[model samples]
Target: MDKKAKALELYLEGFKVVEIAKELGVSQPAVTKMLKQFPEYHQEKERRKKENQEKARQWRNEYKKQKREQYDEDYELVLKSHREDAAALSRRGKLSDDILIKLCILNYDYNKEKERLVFNESAGKRPADLPRSVYVHKNVLKQFRIPTRQ
Candidate 1:
């Protein structure tokens, strides 16, 4: 094939100009000059780039959709298991109203601690807009090396 045809073919196959030059036994500048003589090759390259970008966008959207669905399913399963465990404890006379209240308080404290840990680890700073009562749990604050305000 001629230089132009060979260059176009190599470009369509994802070869860089340098690689095409090596394959065609021409200098890089000469290969560039020849390719520039054909505007259609540049157009084809742009079209391929746009098509690849669209394909990547679609793949990312599909992946995020799949992940969101999976997260929803897993969250539902966890909620159901927690409800079942609570019910089982109630049936065995192990769960009382006061105990349930305490459990809720503990759950709130655990979640706050987890949020603080994640925020501190990521940002290396204290969280903003938090009320004093939120950080009243001394143990959690101590773990993060945050001094408690009196």
Candidate 2:
């Protein structure tokens, strides 16, 4: 076949004008001129452009879906780790089942804060009629983003 047929074939196969020029050992303007001579050139180019754009959009959507799934998996792992830590505390008699259940709904930050509050209170803070667990429950509700409340 002639250069025109070869150029048209390469163009349909998604090769750029510069690439086609290099492949055919011709100048860029020569390749462009040859491609322009075809009656269907503009329409074919537009169709391929739209097709590539759609493929890119689909790829992006799939990437976002995968990232969302990965995030959910990571979130579950974190919750499981927290539950194990709470269970360890319960087994050691450091936490009651009721308090452990409440703390289970909260993240690590709340647990750390609750521990600090308990330490500060035990180290000679002002006395109160309410128990420490009650204060911790109130703090957990007020401070953290509890899923149940949503």
Best by lDDT: 2
Clash number for every model? Answer: 0, 0
lDDT (Cα, tens digit) per residue for candidate 1, span 1-150: 788988978887788889999999999999888888788778877888898999999999999999999999999999999998878687767664444433334323323443332222332433243221232344534443545489
Global fold similarity of model 1 (TM-score)? 0.48
Model 2 worst lDDT run, 10 consecutive residues: 114-123
Model 2 CA lDDT for position 75:
100
In terms of TM-score, how similar is model 2 to the real structure? Answer: 0.49
* 45-148: candidate 2 lDDT, tens digit per residue: 88988999999999999999999999999999999999987787777667654554454333223344443223224435433422343334554445543345
Off by over 4 Å in 2: 1-6, 13-15, 85-150
Please estimate how well model 1 matches the true structure, expressed as its whole-model Cα lDDT.
Answer: 0.67
lDDT of each: 0.67, 0.70
Which segments of model 1 are wrong by more than 4 Å?
A: 9-19, 27-30, 89-150
